[model samples]
Every structure is written in structure tokens, then in C-alpha cells.
Target chain A: EPEVTQTPSHQVTQMGQEVILRCVPISNHLYFYWYRQILGQKVEFLVSFYNNEISEKSEIFDDQFSVERPDGSNFTLKIRSTKLEDSAMYFCNSASDGETQYFGPGTRLLVL
Target chain B: SQQGEEDPQALSIQEGENATMNCSYKTSINNLQWYRQNSGRGLVHLILIRSNEREKHSGRLRVTLDTSKKSSSLLITASRAADTASYFCATDLRRGGADGLTFGKGTHLIIQP
Candidate 1:
């Protein structure tokens, strides 16, 4: 079965640095999303994208974060000026019909 | 919060036994989905039960949704050691279009051999 794929399984960056997490969602899926989980915490929604724009975002998705489908196949999350609290597992997901989203393995981000 | 909250934070069972996990949510949902995560790995979709549907089964996994009560249950029968993982219930709030899911804290299930 086709699955979502993410790059840089693990990322370590300085607190003030910028980082980008990349994902390639299932090719045919139209809706894409980004979620994060702090160690031992429940997964929290970050943002959702469709039709080349953001559909919705949570408070945690502040000015420091942005997402883009730079290309037809690549979906990316960029964080500017990372904070220590930003360390967590970031997951990318996609669904063809907006339900039953399939997730990628996730990128572990550590802001030092 | 619109998130689902699963009951019985943790469970331990012997191999070949059945394990059940329950989830409760505060708001009306369009669909409830069950997912599994092994430690640091990503989530694996297990099954989805729509509000209009009462129950669904896939392999050894069974899921039931009670829309009126705003609760759902996931049952794994004759489970193996491989079934040991954290199980989460996610609620889809949007009635028609796709939306991000609000995940539960999850139940840590350990199957001892």
C-alpha cells in the first residue's frame, strides 16, 4: 500500500535556528495535516492544508510556523526560531477524501 | 477540548487473551478512528467507525461506537505479544469535510507471554 513518507527522521537544532520538516503525502490525497506529540502527551493538531492554502490551525501554530506544498509532491513544515518546548515528534498525514488519514513515520524534532 | 479521552490508562494481559479499551468524547463527532503506536514510532490506523454505524470488525479487532453516549470501544481478541502498544482513539469533528483529528491520551497495552 502507498504510505506517507517523511525526511530527516530526526532533527536537532539550536533554539534560535530555523528548521524544516518535509513530508511526501500519499500521492492522490487532497488533504494534508501536521500534528505533534510531546513525549508522553497526546497528539495535538498543528495545521491542515487543502487547495494550496491553510484550512485551519491551532494556537500552537503561531507565527513561528508555516507549511507549504512547494511542489506537487512535497509537503513541508518550517519553524523559525525554535524553542526548547518545541521539541516533539511531528507527524504528517493525508487523506484522499478528508477521512481516514494515513500518517508518516514522523520526524523527531529536538530544539536545543 | 474536543479531544477523546481513553479509559484505563494501562492494561496488562497474558498472550492469547482479549483486551478492551474505551474512549469518551465531549462533543458530537462525525467518525471515530482507532490507531496504534509503538513507542517512538508513528501511528498506525486500525479501524474507523462512523457515527451512523454502531459496530465494525477487522481481523482480530472490533470497534463499537455509541453516538448517543459519545463513547467508543476497541476490542482485540486473542491478542499476541505483537499487539503490545499504545492505542489511541481520535475524533473527527467535521460533519462533512475532512478535518484534523483530536487524539486521546491513549492506553498502553502490554501483552505478556
Candidate 2:
């Protein structure tokens, strides 16, 4: 089965540095989403994208966070300035019907 | 109470035994989804039960949704050692699939061989 794919499986960056995480969602899916999971914590939604624009976002998706579909295949999440609290496993997901979503392997972001 | 709160944070069962997990949500939901995550890995979609549906099955997995009581259950029957993983129940309000999912803390299952 086709699945979502993400790049830079592991990343270590200094605090205050900018970082961009990339994802390639399933070809035919209409909705894409970003979610993060802190160590030993629940998965938290960051943002959802559709029709080349953001459809919904959470409080965690603040000024420092932004998501874009730069092209037909790539969906990117950029953090203007990394914070220690931003360290987590960021997962990209896509769904064709909006109810069942497939997830990527995730990018582990570590800021120190 | 938080949305999509699961009970029995941890469970240990022997191989070939049945494992069941329960989740409760605070608000109205259009659908409920279950996901399994191995340690430090991504989520694996297990099953989805719509608000109007009472039960759904896939392979050995069984899910039941009760909108009136605002609860759901995931039962993995005749499980194996590979079934050890953290299982989470998420509530989706739909909003045309625009809204984000509210996930529970998850139940950690251990299937001993």
C-alpha cells in the first residue's frame, strides 16, 4: 500500500535555529495533517491542510509554526525558531475519505 | 474528563489471549478511530467506528462505539507477541474533516510469549 513518507528521520538543531520538516503525502489523498508526540505523551494535532490552504490548526501551532504545500507532492512544516519544548516526533498523515488516515514514519526533532 | 481518555494504562497478557481496551470521550464525535504505535514509531491505523455504528471488525480486531454513553472499546482476540504496542483511541468531530483529532493517552499492551 502507498504510504506517507517524511525526510530527515532524525534531526538535531540548536535552539533558536530554523528547521523545516518535509513530507510527501499519498498521491490521491485530499487532506493532510501534522501531529507531534512528546516523549511518553499523547499525540497532539498541529495543523491540517486541504485545497492548498490550512483548514484547521491548534494552539500549539503558533507564530513559530507554519505549514505549506510547496508543490503537488511535498508538504512542509517549518519552525521559525526552535525551542526545547518543540522536541518531539513529528508525524505526517493523509486521508482520502477524511475518516481513515495513514501516517508517515515520523521525523524526530531534537533541539538543544 | 478529557476527550478520548483511555482506561487501564497498561496491560500484560500471554500469547493467544484476548486483550481489550476502553476509551471515553467528553464531547460529541462524528467518528472514532483506533491507532497502534510501537515504541518511538509512527501510528498504524487499526480501525474506525462511526458514531452511528455499534460494532466493526477487521481481522481479529473488533471495535464498538456507543454514542449515547460516549464510550468505545477495542478488542484484540487471540493476540500474539507482536501485538505488544501502545493503542490509542481518537475522537474526530469531522467538521468536513477539517478539525483535528483528540487522542487519548493510550493503553500500553504487553503480549508475553
Candidate 3:
């Protein structure tokens, strides 16, 4: 199993500001995913990446959100403008077969 | 949108007891998977049971899927203090070609040793 590591483990930003969260230590994963869990809420899927492009995204992934696998290995999720509601645990996961996803420790984002 | 709802938002049991968590979904799914998450940590995949298949087991974890009822259950035998965490049931909906999973509000399990 590949070890997934997320940078900055914790992020705090002002509302309406822009923030970029990253997932690294990526090896040979073909499928990458982003999910968020608001406090006391369910883990909701934000987007999925395959073949270097976004294969799918949820409604929560609006215009303000974007995902990129820049530099071929570092996958990132960028929020153009953050809101208080965006405060949550952001998880970055990768899978080899796209079936069983291995998750990162998670980055807890707090927007004031 | 299709979603999974876990029953008994939280559970507590003895270390040697069997722990069970049930989940109900709203739509058709190709498979159901169980995941465990320690407090403020990442999710670890436990097991997956396909729609056509009834039950699947991995280590001490057992998962059962009932397509007719759109429900699933996870059973852990001989639980331990290390087993305390949140268990979530996620569904791979057949309706979506995308591989994103629909996850339920997880059941927080606490094993008292």
C-alpha cells in the first residue's frame, strides 16, 4: 500500500479568501479523489480525477472549486473563494484500480 | 441524490461483544463498502459486498448487502478497544458512471475495555 501524506495538516483562512490544499507522496495511483466532511455531517464527495482530468464532481464543487494534478504527481484542490460553510476536514485519496481508495490523514480547514 | 443513512448514530459495547451497524440507502447500487475512521483521522476501507453477492468478510469484519431492501450491515466480532471509531457505509450507485461514492452519516462506535 502507498502512503498518502497531506501537507499543512491544518489550514485556517479568512472567509472570501482563496486557499489551496494539496495531496502528495503519490506513487502510481490512477484515480484521485477529494471529499469533505463538515463537523457533524456526512463525508461528501467533491470530485474525482482520472487520466489527468476531472472525471466527476458533485454539486458542491461549484465554479469556485477546481482540481489539478499539476506536475504530474501533486494533486491539489483550490477554492477560489472560501466560505464559513467550507470549513471542514478535507481528505485526499488515491486508488490504483479505482475501487479501493486509500485516504490521507486529512487537512482540517477552518474559515473564519 | 442517493444517500446512505446509518442507524443508531452511536453505539457502545464491551470489548468482547459483537458490534453491528446497519445502513439504509435510497437507490440502487453496484456495491456497498464499509470504512472506519479514527477520531480526527482519515478513513480506512474495511470491506465491500456487491449487490449480487450477499456477504463478504475480511479479518474480523463482516459485511452484508441486501439489494431488495437497499440496506447493508457491518458486524465486527470480538471487538477491542482499538475498534473504537466511526464506521461508515458507502454505496457505489449504479446510476452514476462516475466512481464517486455516496456515504452515510457514520455510526460512532465505542468499545469499552
Candidate 4:
């Protein structure tokens, strides 16, 4: 089965540095989402994207966060400045009609 | 902020036994989905029960939804050691907005050999 794929299975960056997490959702999927899970915490929604624009975002997705589908196949999340609290497992998901969401293996972000 | 909260934070069952986990939500939803996640991994979609549906079964897994009570249950019968993982229930609200799924803390299930 076709599945969502993410690059840099793990990322480590300085506290004030910028970092980009990339994902390639299923080719035919229209809705894309980003979620994060702090260690030992529930997964939290970050943002959703459709038509190359942000549909909705949570408080955690402040000015420091931005998502882009720079190409037909790549969905990237950029953090302008990383914070220690931002360290978590970031997951990328895609769904056709908001029914069943397929998730990627996730990228573990560690902000030092 | 309405999310599915699963009960019995953790469960330990013997192989070949049945394990049941319950989830409760606070809002009307279009569908309820169950997912499994291995430690440090991504979520794996297990099953989805729509609002209009009451029960569904796939393989040895069974799920029942009670819309009136705003609760759902997932049962895994004749489970194996591989079934050990964290199970989460996610709610997909009916609103047409950018409503992403809200997940609960999840239940850590461990199957003993």
C-alpha cells in the first residue's frame, strides 16, 4: 500500500536555529496534516493544509511555524527558531476525504 | 479541544486472551478511528467506525460505537505477543472546517507470552 514518507527520520538542531521537516504524502491525497507528540504526551495537532494553503493551526503552531508544499510531492514544515519545548516526534498525515488518515513514520526533532 | 479519552491507561493480557479498551469523547463526531503506535514510531490505522454505524469488525478486531453515550470500545480477540503497543482513539468531528483528529493519551497494552 502507498504510504506517507518523511525525510530525516531524526533531526537535531541548536535552540535558536531554523529547521525544516519534510514529508511526501500519498500522491493522490488532498488533505495534509502535521501533528506532534511530546515524550509521554498525547499527540497534538499542529496544522492542516489543502490547496497549498494552511486550513487551520493550533496555538502551538505560532509564528515560528510554517508549512509549504513547495512541489507537487513535498510538504515541508519549517520552524523559524527552534525551542527546547519544540522537541518531539512530528508526524505527517494525509487523507482523501478526511476519513482514514495515513501517517508517516514521523521525524523526531530534538532541539538542543 | 474535544478529544477521545481512553480508559484503563494500561492493560496486561495473556496470549490467546481477549483485550478490550474503551474510549469516551465529548462531542459529536463524523467518525471514530483506532490507531496503534509502537514506541517512538508513527501511528498505524487500525479501524474506523462512522457515526451512523454501531459496530464493525476486521479480522480479530471488533469496534463498537455508541453515539448517544459518546463512547466506543475496541476489542482484540485471540491476541498475540505482537499486539503489544499503545492504542489510541481519535475523533473526527463532523464540522466541515479544518477539524483535524483529536487523540487521547492512549492505552498501553502488553501481551504476555
Candidate 5:
């Protein structure tokens, strides 16, 4: 079965530095999303992207956060300035339809 | 928040036994999906039940939805030791086309050998 793939399975960055997490969604999927989970916590929705635009975002997706679909398969999430609290596991998900999203293995972002 | 709440934060059962986890949501949803996650890993989609559908099944997993009561249940029958994992229920709300799923805290299930 085709699955979503993400690059840089684990990343370590210093506070105030920039970071970019990349994902390659399933080829035929149309909708993409980014979610994060703090250690031992529930997953939280960050943003949704479709048609090269952001559909919706949460408060955690503030000014420092941005997403881009620079190519047909590559979707990226960039953080302008990383904070200590930004440490978490970031997941990328995609779906052909609006329901039944498939999640990637996830990228663990640790900011010191 | 659109997030759902799951009952019995954790469950322990012997191999070959059955395990049932319950989920409750506050808002109306378009569909509800169940996902499983092994420790320190990503989520694996298990089964989904639409708002209009009351029950769905796949393999040993049985899912039931009660839109009227805003609750759902997931039953894993005759589970094996490998069935140990965290189970979560996610709610997909009706919000045009810009909505992502809201996930509950999840239930940690351990099937003893």
C-alpha cells in the first residue's frame, strides 16, 4: 500500500533557529495536513493544505509557522524561529477524499 | 474543541480475550475513525464509521457509532499479545472542506500473554 513519507526522521535544532520538515504525500491524494503531539499527549491539528493554499490552521500555527506545497508531491512546514516548547512529534497526513487520512511515521523535532 | 474523549484510559486483558474501548464526542461529526499506535510510533488506521452508519467491521476489529448519543465503541475480539497498543478515536467534523480530524487522548491497551 502507498503511504505518506517524511524526511529527516529526527531533527535537533537550537532555539531561535529555523527548521523545515518535509513530507511527500501519496501521489494521488488531494488533501494534506500537519499535526503535532507533545510527549504523552493527544495529537493536535496544526494546519491543513489543499490546492496550494492553507485551508485552516490552529492557534499553535502562528506567525512563526508556515506550510508550502512547492511541488506536486513535496509538502513542507517551516518554523521561522524555534522555541523550546516547539519540541514534539510532527506528523504529515494525506487523503484522496476528505475522510480517512493516512499518517506518516512522523518527524521528531527537538529544540534545545 | 472538536476533540473526543475516550473512556477507561487504559485496559489490560489476557491473550485470547476481548477488549472494548469507548469514545464520546461533544459535537456533530461527519465520521469517526479509530487508529492504533505502538509505543513511540505513528498512528495506523484501523476502521472508520460514518455518521449515518451504526456499525462497521474489518478483520477482528468491530466499530460502532451512535451519532444520537455522540458516542462510539471499538471492540477487538479474540485479541493476541500483539494487540497491545494505544487506541484513539478521531472525529471528522462537517466544516466545508478545511477540516482535519480531532483526536482523543487514546486508550492504552495491554494484552498479556
Candidate 6:
């Protein structure tokens, strides 16, 4: 089965530095999303992208966060400045429509 | 606020036994999905039940939705040791465009062989 794929399975960055997480969604998928899970917490939605635009975002997806579909296959989430609290497991998901999302292995971001 | 809340945070059973997990949601949803996660890994999609559907099944897995009560349940019959993992329920609210799913804290299940 085709699955979503993400790069840099784990990343360590300094606080206040910029970080970009990349994902390649399933080729035929039309909708993409980013979610994060803090240790011992529920998965939290960050943002959704479709048609090269953001559909919706949560409070956690504030000024520091931006998503881009720079190419047909690559979707990226960039954080302008990393905070300690921003450290978490970031997941990328895709779906043909918007109902069932297939998730990637996730990128663990650790900011010190 | 979390949209889905699962009860009985953890469970343990023998390999041949059955496992049941329950979920409650606070809002009307277009569909509800169940996912399983092995430790330190990504979530794997298990099943999805639309609001209009009352029951669905896939192999040994059975999912039931009670929209009127805003509750859902996932049942795994005759589970194996590999079934040990965290199970989460996610809600997709119809009004949101492609905003993605809201997940619960999840139920940690241990199936001992």
C-alpha cells in the first residue's frame, strides 16, 4: 500500500533557530495535514493544506508556522523560531478526500 | 479542548481474549476513525465509521457508532499478542473543510501471550 513519507526522522535544533519538516504525500492524495503530539498528550491538529492553500489552522499554528506545497510531491512545515515547547512528534498525513488520513512515521523535533 | 475522549485508559488481556475500547465525543462528527500505534511509531489506521452508519466490521475488528449518544466502541475479537498497542479514536467534524482529525488520549492495550 502507498503511504505518506517524511524526511529527517529525527531532528535536533537550537531554540530560536528555524526548522523545516518535509513530507511527500501519496501521489494521488488531494488533501494534506500536519499534527503534533507532545509526550503523553493527545494528537493536536496544526494545519491543513489543499490546492496550495491553507484550509484551517489551530492556535498552536501561530505566526511562527507556515506550510508550503513547493512542488507536486513535496509539502513542508517551517517554524520561523523554535521554542522549547515546540518539541514534539510532528506527523504528516494525506487523504484522497478529507475523511481518512494516512499518516507518516513522523519526525521527532527536539529543540534545546 | 479535545474532541474525543476514550474511557478505561488501559487494558490487559490474554492472547485469545477479546479487547474493547470506548470513545465519547463532544460534537457532531462527519465520521469517526480508530487508529493503532506501536510504541514510538506512527499511527496506523484501523477503521472508520461514518455518522450515518451504526456498525461496521473488518476481519476480527468491529466498530459501532451511536451518534445520538455521541459515543463509539471498537472491539477486537480473539486478539493476538501483536494487538498490544495504543488505540485512539479520532473525530472529523463535518463543518471543517480539511482541517484534519481530533484525536483522544488513547487506550493502551496489552495482549499477553
State the weakest 10-residue window (summed lDDT) of model 2 chain A: A94-103
Residue A34 of candidate 3: its Cα lDDT? Answer: 95
Ten contiguous residues with the weakest lDDT in model 6 chain A: A94-103
lDDT against the true structure, each candidate: 0.95, 0.94, 0.89, 0.93, 0.93, 0.94
Calculate model 2's interface RMSD in Å.
0.9
Tens digit of per-residue lDDT, candidate 2, span B6-112: 98899999999999999999899999999999999999999988888999999999999999999999999999999999999999997466667899999999999
What is the RMSD, in Å, between candidate 6 and the native fold over all Cα? Answer: 1.1
Writing each residue's lDDT as its tens digit, candidate 2 over A17-82 gives 999999999999999999999999999999999888899999999999999898899999999999
Stretch of 10 with least lDDT, candidate 5 chain B: B92-101
Is candidate 4 or 6 superior in TM-score? 6
Tens digits of per-residue lDDT, candidate 6, B7-74, equal 77999999999999999999999999999999989999999999999999999999999999999999
Note the DockQ of each predicted structure: 0.80, 0.83, 0.65, 0.72, 0.78, 0.78
lDDT of 3 by residue, B1-113 (tens): 34898887999999999999999998888888899999989999888787889988898988888888888999999999999999999988753344898899999999999
Candidate 5 runs further than 4 Å off? none
What digit string (tens of lDDT, one per residue) describes model 1 on residues B4-106?
A: 9998899999999999999999998889999999999999999999999999999999999998889999999999999999999999998656568999999
DockQ of 6: 0.78
Models 1 onward score TM values of 0.98, 0.98, 0.95, 0.97, 0.98, 0.98
Q: Can you give the lDDT of residue B31 in candidate 5?
A: 92
Q: Give the native contact fraction of candidate 2.
A: 0.78
Which ten contiguous residues of candidate 1 chain B have the minimum total lDDT?
A: B92-101
Best by DockQ: 2
Model 5 Cα lDDT, one tens digit per residue, A15-89: 999999999999999999999999999999999998889988988999999999998889999999999999999
lDDT of 3: 0.89
